[model samples]
Target: MVQDVTLVDGAGSGPAAARIPPAPLGRNRDFLLLWSGASMSFLANRVTTVAYPLIVLWHTGSPLAMSVVSTAALLPLLLVQLPAGALVDRWDRRRLMLVCELGRVAAVGSVALALAAGRVTVAHLAAVAFTEASLAVFYRLAERGAVRNIVHPAHLSTALSRNEARGRAAGLLGQPGGVLLQSAGRWVPFGFGVLGYLVSAVSLLLIRKDFQQERDPTAGRGRMAGEIAEGMRWLWRQRFLRAAFAYVAGTNVLFQMLALALILRVKEAGLPSATLAIVLGIGGVGGLCGALVGGWVQRRARQRTLLIAGAVAWAVLIGAMGFTREPVLLGALYAGTGFVGAVFNVAAAVYQVRTTPDALQGRVAAAAGLVGSGTNALGSFAGGLLLAAWGALPTVRAIAIAMAVLALLAAVAPDLKGELPDDGTDTDAVG
Candidate 1:
């Protein structure tokens, strides 16, 4: 029941060549509602992410307690992605999203109430973080799968680009906002998070369309493990997608390492927390610009061109991180990295949306996420060890060198460079 419409463009030399430009997404009621809801949800989630440790530390006065709760929040990404993706594919995505929003509200709100009553403990916080994050994994998978269903294929790239911008904006503001709110009261940030969930739920209700294509009833469908296996098999069969997944996973590790190294460098330089925040915050603007330009870039260049360009840009920018300790220079380097990352994300997301069948969207996305995010988590851990063993500058230089090598190899991949099949089927594999 999603609305179907075409865009209008300027007339060509002949009237027959004239085209309708796609309705601006800002005017699309459903998309606006979806975007608003998602924005609130992402902001809320990020706020809670910032507040969780602050709350735990305030209560227990122990960094160990904070780490425990933080670990709990992240554990779900490793454990929940595969199964969550399977459920997202099998369940009514919209309804599942609604359930997730409500559950998040209850989880976060309970902690707020408990804090207000001075009843919260480290154990309480850890349990809540884990449970809420587990639900979030499902919500995210469902939303990603649902977006393609809600918009015309012509507009999908722009729509996803906007989504990426929303996430970046949320990241830009959420941490500072959460810390500011917490200054007023420990419970304030979580209360705002609860409000965000309420808003997201209402937005879901306002949406007037189904978010999935009709699936054939699978009364005797094999176990969920089988469904997950099928999704993985489909993803593996696409050489381009498979390579993309590996590429992203590898880059995620590099970025994670870079992040930790940057933080260490900043700390070593005795930069003020405000300066560090500003440095990090500046990177979000690049991501915003990248997202804004993603559709334009995709339209003008081949996917291979963009991929290689982004890779080259990434290597140069990240390599620069090892050569600077100045906050301003580091900030610029980070911004460049974020910009390239956003471009790659939008390009990759469009490819995934266009090529994957609706039935497999959730599963494939989840499978991809498992690899990318799981490694990111590992990278965080390994980054610390590398920093400890080799020091920040050396660790960063090593990572940068590895990145250049990887980008060079990726640029030469035949499957990446070859023309995609014109029939919209991307199954053609070139070695």
Candidate 2:
């Protein structure tokens, strides 16, 4: 007789898989609910991403004011990540997510209502955006930590890849949807976003299973500062993970610079905004395709092979951008870069999920986000400075060369290779 056994939870302890009856992920009702809810949240967030700036620009008619609003929204990432991650690990992830959605509903809905009443101001928009974005930091970290509890271990990679695709699809549609809604009415986009968050909250409420494993009573009892430091220390101790973080950080900077340079190049060539849209659309398609095929790629290739291949592809694609100004060639190169980036993202995400314990997922994610935030800001600064000083082609080539060097370094990290670790031990925490 087949014994009914519970799969090991992401916190690392439960029943052994050898004696358990496996459920196909497709039929896993709880996983489906969580997935659908997350997709809605992502879609709504993307919609607001566009609508926020549009509304600001409409109300103030000043690009400087718009930039200030954007900075206000993003500044929280640097400040909130460390503590947010710690709190997520301490709280009930499902409830945390639900509360976040409700908060978003209030924030976005307030904007809509204010616009309808002709009382919306730039200050109001900035305050709402900052508040909502702050809450989002917690919500996302909580959701990532919670994913492992809802699906089988074998399906985690597939689930994550699907999540990536959902984000890509959201990106592809959300901006256009916001623009169209804005054309109808300024409040329409925010209203649409509010509805999405409400639906998302309903989905969270419908989930029957717990979103976190039972925590050890002593695990999270330390001081908040100590807990945050512990998470960072744990992450740094993993050789491959440290390397992966560096690789991602470097590429993020490179891509940010390259993206800015592309726009400069296009404008210098007198290309229209429509052309820019087409190029971005092509990149989106590439990202979506890569995300969809990520599971297949994971199944077929070793982690080392995937990372190395993706790195090489990025090097080639970015390097090629410097050699041509043809919009079609530039677009194709950009798309290729996006495809490789997606592959790397899936592989890195699987690595992170498999190796880290559920308890520390939030802190680790937050620490990583904190690092990326700094690097991305530096990248934006450097991109504009470099393009202005050296012109587009030369700056593009310099950035590509720097990126290729990083990729080469990543290709040789021994800890990043072979099969996923099977010992089921979080190197930092035995539980």
> Number of the top candidate by lDDT?
1
Q: What is the TM-score of each predicted model, taking all chains together?
A: 0.92, 0.93
- The number of residue pairs in model 1 that clash at the backbone is 9
- Each prediction's Cα lDDT score? 0.82, 0.81
Model 1 per-residue lDDT tens digits across residues 240-334: 78877787888889889988888887877787776677778878888888888877777677777777677788878877877877878888888
Error of 2 at 257 (Å): 0.3
What is the TM-score of candidate 1?
Answer: 0.92
Error of 2 at 106 (Å): 0.8
Q: Cα RMSD (Å) per model?
A: 4.8, 3.9
**For model 1, what is the error of residue 127's alpha carbon versus the real structure, in angstroms, after optimal superposition?**
1.4
